[model samples]
Target: MTYDRCLATLKAISGREAASGYSQRALKQVFGTSKVTFPLSYDRQEFFSKSVEYSKGISISGVQEKLSLRLDRASNELVVTRNNGEYILKPSPEAFPNAAENEHAAMLASQKIGIETALCTLVPFKTGELAYLTRRFDRLESGDKRPQEDLLQIGGLPPKAKYDVSYEKAGELVDQATGGKRAVKLDLFRRVLFAYAIGNNDLHTKNLSLQRAVESSSRFYDKLTPNYDVLFVQAFDNTKEGQFMACDLLTDPETGEEEFTEPYQEYGFYTGYDFLELGRRYGLPERAVIRAIRNQVDSQGDMIELIQSSYMPEEMKREAEVIVVGRCRAISTGIDR
Candidate 1:
């Protein structure tokens, strides 16, 4: 089925059937794609371990292929409606350390240096906050039923939902998501690099998506989703203890607007690990990884100085630098990968 049909179906299901053709069309573009095939690769074990090793600085959702919705956000993808039309809420969060702003900064920087990103809108939330939300590329695969969860169900074993999908399966998943007719983008290479340099470790299947479709019944094709959730570890003070690393995530549940800085956790992290692993998943060269590490070290001062001036105090900024820079040096040269 064509993506237009899929859009029609999803909109109907969401009770947005009467939401105006133009609005629905806008939504359709978010999930549309050219149909084509391009070879891809993966390595889950490497990604998982590296994700943790790389995340040694903060709690992360572990890499996901897509940000599929559950029963909770069952109705709408971006905004939530309730009260039987009495009230509606959007997915915007009113919190510290803007995730969208960092994403925009990072994307602009990455693209300036020639990186590929589907690109996204800098949407403002009701809370006066902004967060980058990428569109889902995978279609409603519950037999093309257009269920919201279908987005999450991709990348797993066949005839099964929620099957284990790994990094190695990334290529295959990309094929299906992109309709086997999309170009193999080199910008993704830069995305992996820039994400590391900026510490946007939230790279997962959901965060990364494809836009595939067959317009006018011509053919199928796809491309990776735009960069979203590009928040940086340095965006906040990060001074809270036990907030960094994969171990901390695997161990407990956390709540609070704490600093992503140090005392770090028992794992010893100053910032976040996404910086290191973003390169690892793509099989980045050791030279590249080392270069990224060194670059961050060199640039940390400027970054910290900037942060101190804006969102944090001098002591908080200094602590972040010590934890992040000192430990990064230790790990960068010694990492086995």
Candidate 2:
């Protein structure tokens, strides 16, 4: 949707309803600022477009229609990521509407919530004539400034397994993929929260990544990066609740389960996260969890704006709210029944 239409819709919604109790950060996401417009000189569908021959691993087939793979530049993302071999090309007038915009919002939301995620910034792509592209977390071993552009989701444990089916399995996979050096505490929780907050139900085992950063500028740091690939696919399909929740096998922490076992089973999702126990393990506070929830609620407008600008129509927008806010709220204060 155009900025004018987005604003008008929000105005209409705001006038019709009142703040339904959201977090401050969530509110900012609903209408904080303009999406950073990326410059692009390359059009993927152009008559003279060039298709580079990189390994096609585990990306959603046919998604490149709206995105092109290319190297982009920006100072902000420089320090955050180390050696991404390739950067995903995101062109303007993109094949799909508002995907790039929604992604940008997801990353910004991750940062706002104190998650240890990759540094992200919108930059021009396609020779700075077409549109903007979001970079990846993988580093290039080939030694060219433009990383090889291997899709991060393709790098999960055991090479090409899904994470959504079982998180404990994912934990073990993380150890295997990274050769036993998993940043369990920081990496896992952030990913869990990010998936919930951004509505990224597609976070299958393949979607989450484990980077082996170069120790001597050659040996990669064998651990997970903050988080990436943050867009809600459930929005595209009518499945807006972001399915794939289950009673995953709860692992045996004391026994030190094998690193590759699919420990958790899929139990149904609880409306909100009760971090009281989880927070204690990480030395994090339950208040922090509450604060995060509040931020998501408060900045819901910005989140709404991002969605409104994307392929999501106004009707779907209301549906998204029913699921997103409703589910989030259900978990937050339901200390008892």
Candidate 3:
């Protein structure tokens, strides 16, 4: 059976067919409205005409070109907006082939592994080229904006220096921001492991952020936001570097040097031991750490199924599967090959 483009689920849920090329669950997740006829009036060509103007309103920076857009429920379409945009539209850049599909599949995989992620799905332009559409979590249904800050800002680093810090430091920042909350720290550990398992080498400082809780009665006001900007960057041809992670897993506090495990030195890449050591250093519970690693290790079958069912081209799908399986192997065992 063919899968639906929005959620990659079987075409029929229960007994009803998805007339809109989207499953009911996907429509609810992405649009939050029950209407099944949501459409975008403009295509990629028209998007290029206004990308510069629309991007000016976007605050996030990355390799992909994105436009700020808002949904017009009355018109049943998405319209480009200069301000108060509720959704971010990312089209495949000329250099990255099938990036929309890559990102969508990655986000879906993240969810399957129990990582909380922003609402996202693939929406086609008027001409039929698919683009990644993610709903902004900071925006409330009541039109109020929540305070959200990325780790770069929290670390007091400039945007250009986002890659200069280590993942260990990032974890410390999260710990401090949430008053040493163990739940958030466990989430951080899971995020770090998931990134490695998928070969996503772009989980830099700017990509991780915390959002201020809307309710004052909550236990912690500053909470880690859902995962965003996740994709299999290593699957691309241009990113053939030997680096398994974007940032160093750890650095000596006094010596200020990159620290590695003996297995890392021998295998030339991080292994299960390195991640376990990281969890230990972070003070994560022994059971939680083991469970997190085991979850990722066991996700191989589900991840491969999701990749095969994704909208990525046949070639890209195979590349992504190989990368995921290889990384999962490294995380499951000390062997790199």
Candidate 4:
């Protein structure tokens, strides 16, 4: 369906049309209808006051102000009760313009590239302000919390040490999680390549997680969770000079040794060769990496279409298109060599 800002006509978090405007059927299948609307009548000053007050005991961590909510289907509104919340709501940050819209677009782009990203949608607050809503993957339908550990936790590092490792090292952790399954490694490789292509430089350890069924008896069978907190930070930031990646993807070229180093940035921007080398290091077939890049090149049109249909402002949409298209071209050219 065509993209629109109206909740009823807009795309649902499931990436499907809510033809009847978040009808009972749609809400039941996606977000429960009991979702409560925010206290929209409050002014900016009052909004934050209530937000902070409601978020007092809720403990989700991040730079943005977010709160957990339970949908009161009977009222067709979202409530901030202390009950187990099935969804997380992120309002627009006062410091960042269009942050919510940017996140929604980025998450949608990730899904278009065959990555399983967190399902999210842009919903209007009662005050008519739009906010981003994402379903919690760690929460089960039966109201039980799934066992989940971020890469930082899985690697035995604290939150403060999130940047102490490289994306390559994170792949090693994934290998350990999947018991050296080549498919999982390949999936990690593709995710890294996709992150680089889309300028998602903030993919630190905390953003990646391993999750499994709480009911499952096997403790060693966790799988990589859906990608979350993805955004095109490079497109919005002017500096673009802070290492370009959360962790090193390759070794330092200055050492003249064949081994890769921690926090490597020998090459300015990640090229196709970098991805190929990373795949090779992870035991992925070279042809498969090349094929994936080519597939990305072929899918450029679809990406652009999704961007055009996104809720992002026109200027931001254009900026994202340029960055994404240029990166895809660079990958294709690098691979040709």
Ranking by TM-score: 3, 4, 2, 1
Lowest lDDT 10-residue stretch of candidate 2? 1-10
Q: Which stretches of candidate 1 lie over 4 Å from their true place?
A: 1-92, 97-100, 118-151, 156-172, 175-189, 213-221, 238-337
Give the Å error, residue 153, model 2.
11
- CA lDDT of each candidate? 0.37, 0.43, 0.79, 0.69
lDDT per residue, candidate 1, 1-337, as tens digits? 1111111112222233232211345344443422211110122233234434433222123222212221123333232212122111112223334433444444444433444543433333333233343433233334242222222445543422222333223444555554543243233434443444444444444444544442334233345554544545443444133223211111111532222323244445433343344334445554665565555455555544443332223554455445545544544443334
* Per-residue lDDT of candidate 4, residues 237-289 (tens digit): 44245455677775434562234422234554566767777887777788888
RMSD of each: 16.4, 9.7, 3.1, 4.6
Would you list the rank order by lDDT, best first?
3, 4, 2, 1
Q: How accurate is candidate 3 locally (lDDT)?
A: 0.79
What's the TM for model 2? 0.56
Which candidate leads in TM-score?
A: 3
In model 4, what is the error at residue 254, expressed in angstroms?
13
Q: How would you encode candidate 3's per-residue C-alpha lDDT over 143-247 as one tens digit per residue?
A: 778877888888889988787778888888888777888888889889989999988888888889987777755544367899998988887777757477878
Off by over 4 Å in 4: 1-29, 32-47, 56-62, 237-242, 251-267
Best by lDDT: 3
lDDT of 4 at 106: 84
* RMSD over all Cα atoms, model 1: 16.4
Give me candidate 3's TM-score against the actual structure: 0.91
lDDT of 2 at 106: 57
